[model samples]
Target: MLHPDLKAQPSRRLPEHGLAEAVALAAALPDLDVVGQDVVRVAKAVPATLFGSGKVEELAAALRAAEVDLVLVDGPVTPVQQRNLEKQWGVKLLDRTGLILEIFADRARTREGVLQVELAALSYQRTRLVRAWTHLERQRGGLGFVGGPGETQIEADRRAIDEQVVRLRRQLDKVVRTRELHRSARRKVPFPIVALVGYTNAGKSSLFNRLTGADVFAKDMLFATLDPTMRAVELPTGFRVILSDTVGFISELPTQLVAAFRATLEEVLEADLILHVRDIAHSETAEQAADVDDILTRLGVDKSVPMLEVWNKIDLLDPAARKSVEDRGAASEGIFPVSVWNEDGLTPLIEAITRHLDEERQHEDLVIPFADGRARAWLHEEGVVEQERVEEDGVHLAVSWTARQKGRFADI
Candidate 1:
């Protein structure tokens, strides 16, 4: 792995740390074994190879010494640079975007997720058509009858890609429409949605499993969970809610993914509550938090939706540091410190979610006709019917429900 620290484009993370992240990203792929890594300091990127010739030579020797089969570049590499680097290093080359695409392709399990990853991968590959097909230089003479010139290999490949992209988009649109219908259906179920979101590998999935009794793939790896998972969970106050576990955010997330996976992230937009889980023990926890917040802003999550910061993985911290974190959380309004592994401080987190949901509750009296048994049953099913009395005109009911439940009841 090579993390090129270009002078013009500075990163929020240290060069060494960035290289470490790239290694971790490579490790996420099961088929690849990471043998060597480095941070290459560059005054400016070489247009052809990204690294200077001397740096390239040095890396080539290192690669040979390490017996590395592939070189992962932790930054964007133009098509020209990618081709040149692979030739000079005599190894397969993958840039950050390509590495991420591979990981997404491996992790996506659902139909929608698989489609999204394919679309994003095609989009990324579309730009590198020159490097993808070596026959771009070959030309074919046109037959006199049909066209002026026969299509080149590059043109044919690009046309094929364009057609595939169109087909995938059409399929993805249908899938997204179906998902929206599902969302509409969930809206009528009278359960508030609480979504868990945070930086990748921040234990969002672990916490989700602990809270919802779900067996979602949870591991200490980046992007352990890709497709969103939802489960019904009851808060301490007897308030039942739908908890959604979504793909985690990361610093410098690929633009292709952000656009392609927007459909999956709609759950976060519709959430009644957002839980921003964090790995409090990580060295760059604050920076990771900022990255997550930035992505949320980019996603246009409603500012009105209540968010609670979960300081997870306290088990990794020392006792004094853990106490400090707990005290800080207590002093704050929307922060909670907990360790999902230890099952510590989860009750308060649940209570906080219940409080946020209950804050929108309103009490109202409604008159229902004797024949409207469905509406009455809905109110009872939602556990919001506080009192009811039968009258000559109709049945009088007093109910306490959140605004969302009231809207659903209104529909009934």
Candidate 2:
């Protein structure tokens, strides 16, 4: 449901354009099956409650009438307010973060993704602990399962939750270790990683499938691609880079989710290049970029790292928009436009990716003695050797590599 925040103030009216953008965002979450919706318009001086008593009553009534199993708030709700509202309404109340987390939980299919979602869920549940267990005041346990040695319900539930949390963490730690091993194997191969990051519904998964020819689950829904998928793509210059499609960013992302997905997002921090794909046709394109950049900054990735902005979804834009995105924004060096659906205007984007990779890589010329053929073979296998010439006593080649790679070659 679109929130009241997107509404234009009537007298001090905002452009009605934002409404369409909000609808687009909502449309992206088709998998949510978001049944019941309520738009609670708070006053200029909104109370800490966000929703007033009157609105709360109306919401409770509507929820009862609709039999909505879930209530999704389009904005952030404090842990205290969330617990209070759930009690007041007698139904599960989920804020934007909770909805996103639920979406992630549903979308996550891989081990890493499952672990990340569990971590995020645990973190979120930790904060709202004060609210969830208060119903345990009347501890009456008369069930035959415990042979009449039944403990108070609240205490029993708390113990169970604590045990589950501990078990979940241990399992997550094992998953993290498994991820590290996979990461190590990739390092042994040592391909430069190019990560696609952008706002949800920006066609990141589409671009990833387009570039790598990998059929990942790409849909119009928000958070559709929760598990990170990587594929090897060969550039025009025969350079094979690993392209990863990560979970999309959104404005006001939950801190719990961020912490939960930190391990997954390490793809961005460790990447050689980032393709900042955007839904250029969206009216809030600028705001979307700001949200993505904000997350990047918090990730502590070097601002100076090379980036290629491949503004996507040109097919949805009008002729005027296409012209503006292609011509009007003469702002940056590597910004290009593409439509992943129709395969429109992708050459420039690919070229920019190649250019960024070339610029970031360090090139060198090295000669290895014939006696050290193992070193020569290792260099050829691991490093990006541009060219090699066989000599009477040695192998000579030009190589472009990372610092770790260069050090390994030097030792050889």
Candidate 3:
């Protein structure tokens, strides 16, 4: 944990003052709270060894004063840099990527998520095996009593990791199949799915709850909604649909995470439409939007799926700026500015969604025999019967619904 500052100092990836976002993320970890106030920085070229020499000395002094146990670096540090820093500072140190992976490893609850993290960790470890080596390879051949020469620890670790990787891949295949089965089940009923997607901590969960009245753990924290939450919602006029609050997108989202959460993200890929609920007030709103769009591209949803730019948290925006944003979006594609907290500007947003869904709606005028009570009931239960009348020859009905729902009444 070398405290680094690059604000006044300059560097390629991040300057001294440029590391606030990086450090802010590091500080979010509760486990690092003990050293939160003690972390320091050195913004210039990182020494090949410690990445911080003078800064390391200062950090050592500070740790001694603060009685700290660890140093957390906000940027990537090579294995050599980490080991050198530890050896010099006589304290544990961690880099950004390693710290994030550790958090994911600890928080992973599902089988697929755990396996994905383990695979990423194994891959990361394999690259830095330099941290571990042994003298056993220099040993002479084993005695004749032994079956064969013992393998070096490095070779053994590699083989074990490879075995685990293969096992995880097989397990993930089963998980994928299970997800596909659930998808098929949902398709049979065929309620239109709407997915909430946006930057981490962008209030996706809050908007989700506001729209569907579903109580999900909505919090002002990064990755607050890790698991996908689904609820059945009846829009005004009894228009039923399925609403899904899927995992939020973020900048530089770890590849391991994207792969592990594929099952959850499937909601977005398969959604009838995606609501990009963004925090319009954040300073990085534009950048966050770009990041979300980039991830959408990676998910192959950028060009394929219909996306609605939902500028959430409008109350936080200045009135003038908010008006400007809404006005800019007014003439554009699917877009709406709304505040989920105050429930302002939601009617139009919901209407916009219904309009998008209109394309999926099928209308038909059909007549069922007067004696066919079952067909009449089917039409009422499955399709939205816009009009119904009774005549001596048959029961006449005008219906609008999805093709799947229409199929349910094909017998009529």
Candidate 4:
């Protein structure tokens, strides 16, 4: 893996840290055996190779010495640059976007997850198909208006990609509709959704397992949990909520991926509460948090939805740092510093979650018509009906419910 540190560009992370992240990204793919890594310095990005010829040759020699089968570039590389680099280095080359697509493709398990990864990969592949058909850029015999330049090889490849994209989107839309049906059913159940989101390897899965007592795949690797997982749990306050564990965010995530995986992330849009988990022990914790926030914004999450910052992995901190976090968590309103591994500072976090949800509830009076037994039953089923009485025209009831529950009742 190579992380190019361009002199002309400023980065929030140090070059060495960026290189280490690249290595971690490569590690996410089980088939990859990362034998070598480096932070390559670049005064200016070469359009054709992204590196000066001399530096490219030097790195090529090193790659050969290490018998590296693949070179993962930890930054954007143009299709031309990728082709040239592969030729010079005598190995397969994947840019940051391509590498991420590989990891997603490898880790995706569900039908929707698999389809989204394939769609993103196809989009990435379509761009690289540009130079592959350069030699066949010629017109073929066809009607002038019908085929334009007679559908060259690149055009054919792109057309095929477009068709595949359309098919994948159709299948994905079916999957999304099914998911929406499930979501609609859940909305009727009166349990609010609390989604867990953070940068990759920030211990979201571990926190999820701790909170729900479900054995989700939790590993100390990037993108370990690719599919969204949700489990309904009754809190200490006896209020129930559906806790969601979603795919982790990363800095400079591919645009293709952001678009393709939007369906998977729609869980966040429906969340009544968001838990922005952070790896406080990471050197780039702040930067990672910023990335997660940016992606959430891009995903069009409603700002009105309540959110709590979960400063996780506190066990990794030193005594002083941990004490500082504990103090900050105590002083702050929406921050909870906890270690899911050690089970420290969790009770307060759970209390805070329940409190936040409960605080949204308001007292409401409703006179249900005798014909609307379903709505009245729903109110009783939700356990929010504090008082009841019988009236002349209908059954009068007093209920305490959240705005969402009130809306659901209205729908009913």
Candidate 5:
């Protein structure tokens, strides 16, 4: 794998860290061996090969010496550049987007996840037909670009891809509608959703397992869990909430993927509380947090939604650093430091979550007219009614309900 460190471009991570991440990404897939990796510095990216000729030749020699089968570039590589680089290096090549797509394709287990991965991969493949089909000037019939063999075949392939895209979209829409039905059912149940989101390999799955006791696939690997998993947990306050473990976010997540997985991430948008988990032990924790925040903003997460920062992996910290984190967490309002491995600091974190979720509820007095038996029954069914009285004109009641519940009541 090669991570290009162009002198002109600003980066959130050091090139070596990026390369390390790239290696981890490669390791996510089974049967792929990373023979060698490097942080290749480039004064300016070459339009044709993405590296200077000397650098390219030097790396080509190294790859050849190692008998490498594939070259993974941890950056964007244009179709032309990809073709040129593959020819010069005599190896199969994949750019960062392609590598991530491969991992997603491997990890997706649910039907919806599979369809989303296919849709994203197809979208990416559609843009790179140039490298795939090189016979651009073969003439079959008519005139100009339309009738040429290369254009004719490319057009035919694109049309086929377009048809497949439409079919995948239709299937995905059905899956999305099913998911919406489930969300609607959950909404009626009145359980607040608390979603866990963070950078990949940030121990989100581990924390989720610790909290919910569900046997989700938690591993020390990037993109360990792709499909969202939800489980109900009763807090220390006896308050029930649906805890969601979502796909981990990463830096420079492919745009195609962001669009394709929007439905999968709608759980985050609907969440009553978001736990921004961080691997406090990681060197780039701040940059990783920024990346997660940026993705959340792009996903249109509401600023009004409550969020808590979870500084996880305190067990990995030195004694003094861990103490500092504990002290800071004590002094802060919405931040908690915890070690999921040993289950330290969880009681306080759970209490904080309960407090925040409980704060969403408010007391209100309501009068249901005699004609509105349905609304009255809904309030009772919701178990929010604290007291009730039957008056001459209506049923008067005191209820403790969430804003979401109140909105639903208004609809009724």
Candidate 6:
């Protein structure tokens, strides 16, 4: 893995940490055995080779000595640059986006996930086809002067990819519609949704398992959980919530992925509460949190929707550090310090969630006309009706519900 630290680059993550993350990303793929990793400082990127020829030769010699089969570049490598690097190093090469796509392809399990991965991969592959063919002017037999063999091949390949993309999109659209129907069903259940989101390997899944008691694929690896998982969880205050565990975020996440996974992330948009879990022990926790927030913003998550910061992995911290973190959390609003593995400080976190939910609830008295049976029934179905009284002109009721539920009732 090589992280090219270009000068004056604006990035949220430190270059060294980015390099480490690149190594972790490379290690996420089971087939690839990472033999070497380094941070390559590039004062300026060469358009053709990314790195200077001398630097490329130096790295090529080192890779040869290490017998590396693949070189994972931790930053963007143009198609031309990738081809040049592969030729110089005499090894297969993958850039940041390509590496991420590979990991997503390997980790996706659901049909929708598979479709999204394929679409994203095809989108990425379409861009690199420029380097796929060698001959650009060799003539091919055609009905007319339609250009050379290379142009024909490129056109045919792109046409094929376009067809595949269209098919995948059709399939994905159907899946998305089905998912939307499911979401609509959940909306009628009166259970608030709480989405867990964070940086990759930040223990979001472990926290999810601890809360919901469902065995999801939780591991100490980057992009461990690609598909979203949800389970109904009853809070301490008897309020039921659907807990959603989503794919983790990363720095410089591929654009294709962000666009492809938008449907998967719609759960976050629909969430009544979002738990921004953080690996509190990681040195780049703040940076990671910022990345998650940035992605959330890009996804158009409503600012009005409440969010809580979860300082997770406290077990890994020393006692003093843990106590300090706890104190910091206590001093702040919407912050909880907890170790999911040790099950420490969970009570407060759960209580905080309950408090946030309760804070959103408003008690009101409504007068529903006797003819409006549907509205009264909805209030009853939502379990927010506290008391009811029959009157000559209408039905008087005392109810408690959140703003969302009230809006839903008004729609009814």
For all the candidates, what are their Cα RMSDs to the real structure? 3.5, 5.6, 4.1, 4.5, 5.2, 5.0
Among the numbered candidates, top TM-score falls to 1
**10 residues in a row with least lDDT, candidate 4:** 132-141
lDDT of 5 at 223: 100
Positional deviation of residue 61's Cα in model 5 after best superposition, in angstroms: 1.2
lDDT of each: 0.89, 0.75, 0.72, 0.89, 0.91, 0.89
Q: Please, what are the lDDT tens digits per residue for candidate 4 over residues 102-141?
A: 9999999999999999999999989888574356576565
Give Cα distance to truth, residue 363, candidate 6, Å: 12
**Candidate 1 lDDT over residue span 1-412, tens digit each:** 8889999898777888788888999999998988777788999988988988898898899999998888899999998898888888889999999999999999999999999999999999888987554778776656654223866767766777989999999999999899888888876675789999999999999999999898999999999999999999876544689999999888888899999999899989989999999999998899899999999998999999989999999999999999999999989989999999999999899888888886467889999999989988878877888899999989999988877777767776
Residue 38 displacement (Å), model 3: 8.6
lDDT of 5 by residue, 1-412 (tens): 9999988997988999999999999999999999888999989989999999999999999999999999999999988899998999999999999999999999999999999999999999898877454664343464564445344666766767889999999999999999889988987767889999999999999999999999999999999999999999977544579999999999999999999999999999999999999999999999999999999999999999999999999999999999999999999988899988999888988988988887467889988899988988888777788999999979999998777778778776
The window of 10 residues in a row where model 5 has the poorest summed lDDT is 137-146
Q: Candidate 6: which pairs clash?
A: none
**Candidate 3 local lDDT, 1-412, one digit each (tens):** 3445545553433333225455555654666664444334444556566445666677667777877677777656777787777777777877766766776676566776677677777776765565433442443345444324764555556666778778878887898789789889987767788888898778889988888877888877666666677898776545678888877776666665666667668878889988988888887778789888888888777467788899888788888998988897687767788888899889998888887774467778888887788888876765389999888889889888776666756645
Ranking by TM-score: 1, 4, 5, 6, 3, 2
What ranges in model 1 sit over 4 Å off?
131-133, 141-150, 359-412
lDDT, candidate 2, 351-374, per-residue tens: 777876743568888887878878
RMSD of 2: 5.6
- lDDT assessment of candidate 2: 0.75
Stretches of candidate 2 exceeding 4 Å from the true structure: 2-38, 44-49, 60-69, 83-90, 131-134, 138-162, 329-331, 359-412
* TM per prediction: 0.88, 0.76, 0.82, 0.87, 0.86, 0.86
After the best TM-score superposition of candidate 3, give how far the Cα of residue 269 lies from its true spot, in angstroms: 3.1
lDDT of 3 at 31: 64
